[model samples]
Target chain A: MVRWEPGAQERLAAAALELYASRGFEQTTAADVAQSVGLTERTFFRYFADKREVLFAGQDHFQQLFVANVAAAPPEASAMEAVSFALDAAAVFFPDERRPHSRLRQSIIDANPGLHERELLKLARLTEGMAAALRDRGVPEPQATLAAHTGVTVFGVAFRLWVGEHEERPLGAIEADVLRDLQALSPSVR
Target chain B: MVRWEPGAQERLAAAALELYASRGFEQTTAADVAQSVGLTERTFFRYFADKREVLFAGQDHFQQLFVANVAAAPPEASAMEAVSFALDAAAVFFPDERRPHSRLRQSIIDANPGLHERELLKLARLTEGMAAALRDRGVPEPQATLAAHTGVTVFGVAFRLWVGEHEERPLGAIEADVLRDLQALSPSVR
Candidate 1:
């Protein structure tokens, strides 16, 4: 039985993730993802290249979000401040409603070495994008790159906490906690 | 005619890297690598699964070095200090004679997306391994992860500088400079 749904792309993506989680990514096909959503393989192809893309399709947009937010920071902001702003701005990407989905997606990624590598690559790209944005804001070589990397690390740490079982705090709050932990890494920062 | 060599694996790896750099990683083959070194494909197989292993064969040893150094840090050292000690300890992995080879290898990786992803994954694992080491030394969750990530970032930035043209400093000195730059990111740290 097939039924039409609004946001065909979103539905297909969701279905692909679910199928990848249960059946394993290698076992899931494009047609399987589409059929799970009561859609056709043609419709899935229109939205994504394959089942693997269901996890990575948002990477470019996510990188853009980090870059844009960094670029939008106030002129007086330090490189770290710019990254801090970007980190806060990234919370919209994981609203209260999206945590469960994010957790599931993360689990799927963690369970597969190839998918985990893809996840790390995307985060590496995000760090590069943020560094470029910071450089454009007049932050110097190592500082821009360092701050960008730091922010991304915080994001990674906070994201895991956000998706963890007993954690109920928002991503921004967790990021603040992680940022503090980052600052406390040395006696100087303390 | 093949000549007996004292370091056949090293010779074949060197040949593989040269071929990959000149002809592109995708264009190179295991047989080509072996033939370039005056050896047979079967000999190459005994040392490596495929041509790609030429670039990645040291990853486990690399991770082990990091984990070992982190574990050997002074008991009273903070998470960041332990990472700093490990960073300095890693200089042995890149001697003056190896800089040119590393530079060539990095260039090859930068030119290939698959290789670049593998590079990032290796670094990510290094970070995780260091973090786990910190945890074993009694550092807590987010702080251990944060410090581990910051150290790896410094190592990355320092490795780039070490390999860059006109940079005369050793890997240890460049790491110190990058670590200083990382500390100066936030105003409080300054």
Candidate 2:
């Protein structure tokens, strides 16, 4: 019988990231991660499909957050506003405490092509999910997709700033700054 | 001694796409594509690293076209305008003759996760390349990246319309229509 163990998933994820950082992603094994967490390999498998998935364990939850926030935005909001609302809602997930882990995770991803591709896939999925949510809110096609993709782009730029070595600003501040920058990207401004 | 033959690459690509459409991408092989083109496997490898690459053989040329056009746009043009010029230039590469092949390629990519991921990566590379070109043209940061990515988004939407079974418009027309739609997506416009 499987026993309910609180924080097992978090423990496994932390252990996996630490191992990936110290030993390189390619050299790390499921057994090493499980052992570091004082858990069995079976337990590790229960939390992640493979070592790479440990880095993306929160993707589904994050995607859900984005979709739910977009759906919850006021109907009067424009497509871009709705998308910004979703991104602002998603920003709460990245707190100050997670900054160190996020930094390490980004480095690990940068070092591995497979992980980089998975990250891109996750972002792509989030974009699609956001677009679908906007459509459900009576937003039209092409615009919905365009706005959703733009939201992802905003999030990406903000994320880099939020996690930069010299950046002490909160993710929310970075997001607002990035959104303003996006608005300033008008053709007439040049 | 290997003989240099004209149109060998094009013939291989056409044959590969035809086979992929008829027999499925997974079931098709480089040998089969070569045989279909009456060429040796070595000759096929000379043009593409693998069977999957046959669909993406034009990516490099297209990227060059985008960067060159962005650099060649009028110096006073806005970042978005420069990007639009690049997209308009790249549209020439996808004339009506390539429409059917493009349609089939999109279907194949939609049906396969690997191919879909590859397509996204290709687009990402093009976006980066365009951003660099924009920067080289004295466009500033954030706006440069934003404009380049938005250009890719416009290209994506226009490409879909241009290749849609019911659409009869040329790529350039669709690009203009999509760019107009994007401009209309401002927050004030709803």
How far residue A140's Cα lies from its native spot in candidate 1, in Å, is 2.0
Task: Give the alpha carbon lDDT tens digit for every residue of A1-190 in model 2.
Answer: 7977799999998888899999999998999999987899988888899888898877677778888898899989888888878777867889889899889999999899888877877887788888899899888888888888888888887887887898899898888877777667764321
Off by over 4 Å in 2: A188-190, B188-190
List clashing residue pairs in candidate 1.
Answer: none
lDDT of 1: 0.84
Query: What residue pairs are clashing in model 2?
Result: none
lDDT, candidate 1, B75-98, per-residue tens: 998888788778877787888898
Cα lDDT tens digits for candidate 1, A103-129: 888888889988887788888888888
Q: In model 1, which runs have C-alpha deviations exceeding 4 angstroms? A: A1-6, A21-27, A187-190, B1-5, B187-190
Write candidate 2's Cα lDDT for B1-190 as tens digits: 7899799999998898888888899999999999987899999999899888898877777778878999999999888888878887867888888788788878888888888878888887788898899999898877788888888888887897887888888898888877777777774311
Worst 10 residues of 2 chain A by lDDT: A181-190
DockQ of each: 0.52, 0.46
